[model samples]
Target: MVQSVKPNPQGGITVTCDNKEEHFDKVIFTSPLNVLTKVADSSLFESSKPKTPVEYLGVICLVLITKSSLTPYYVLNIADKEIPFTGVIGMSSLVDLDQTGDEHLTYFPKYVSANDSYWKKSDEELKSLFLEGVSKLYPDFDTNDIVSAHLHKAFKVQPLQVLNYSEIIPDVQTKHKDFYVLNTSQFVNDTLNNNSVVNHVEKFVNEFKTESNLQ
Candidate 1:
């Protein structure tokens, strides 16, 4: 069997896993545009192809385990740059547990960028920095009280919302024969849960049925 997909002509792909060389009829990629442009066969689209720019940020969240309770809030969004990382959250806010009566303090410092020097350090060092951040947030916090530490690292946490994002919305059903593409990120500008893509799906369904000469 053979599969064909179209977008930009400069399509290049590499299969990382060891799998049988079986073929298919069609493939739909639901990845970022930056990556898609590479795997897409640009020529299939003919005239012009709309492109969008996307930037991402990495975040490292530190979970500090303490012997005392912190705050009542679940999410703490830190907007201050001087604080090194983002806000902290009390784990108890989300999970329910026996009120051991003994206090439990849990918070995290989110480093916006992974390239920072802090990211270069060992896990224990990173944990220490996180505890340090907590002390800074609350001067009365004692670093010695921390009994455990945890770290969570996530890439693409925040995508820099680019301008003119509305101008690049693409139709899944293109003029090319048997060529269709759908990306949730493209429809995530002003609406949530890819509302734009949902609307496009509806339109595509109607058009596809009509194009197929189906009543």
Candidate 2:
């Protein structure tokens, strides 16, 4: 894990990882924006901080290993306000049966804001709540078919777009020459996903190469 990152006056940025120090001409930070705020040294940025104060949504995903598939569709978006989960992702529908060891894999994803009460729920509570919601949706789904249940939670899953986002978004280039902030928060017109990430990185690489040549 990276402990700290500071700019070296001579040249490059000095990074401290696991108590050891190393110098790098450039640092490409791809982790979540919140991580950057926590790990980066105050002096690393030109103004002591980047102007990226963005809110991120969290997710609590419950994975169910079942004897039979729940839905034929790969994804079931829950439109009802009464439902607990935002969407149901049928992993089994997308993956081959052999890869799942002949079992069905389903995901119940619930997105939560920072102050959402779902964060306080224990594993058992979440299981009960999720299964209850699932049961209501698919009456034919049997509890006996559930081979195993797993809960996964991420506090910072993705950035939530806010008002005047374009004006306040963090730049790829920081005041400090060697330090750059590149993350999902920079995604203005595109959705946050694997494809967008790859495209963004490729775009950044091309631009950086051109800029480096000019410099």
Candidate 1 lDDT by residue in tens digits, 143-214: 677777788776654444467655554433434444555555555544422345678678767876686575
TM-score of each: 0.53, 0.75
- Distance from true position, residue 53, model 2, in Å? 2.2
Tell me the lDDT of candidate 2: 0.83
lDDT of each: 0.58, 0.83
Model 1 clashes, total count: 9
How accurate locally is residue 66 in candidate 2, as Cα lDDT from 0 to 100?
97
Candidate 2 residue lDDT tens string, 1-215: 89888888888888899999999999877677557767787666532244667788999999999999899988787878777899999988889999989999999999899899999889899989989999999998889999999999988878887877777766544667667777787789777765688898998899999888988
Model 1 lDDT, residue 27, Cα: 43
Give the clashing pairs for model 2.
none
- Per-residue error (Å), model 2, residue 206: 7.5
Q: Candidate 1, which ten residues in sequence have the lowest lDDT sum?
A: 8-17
Root-mean-square deviation per candidate: 8.1, 3.9
* Most accurate candidate by TM-score: 2
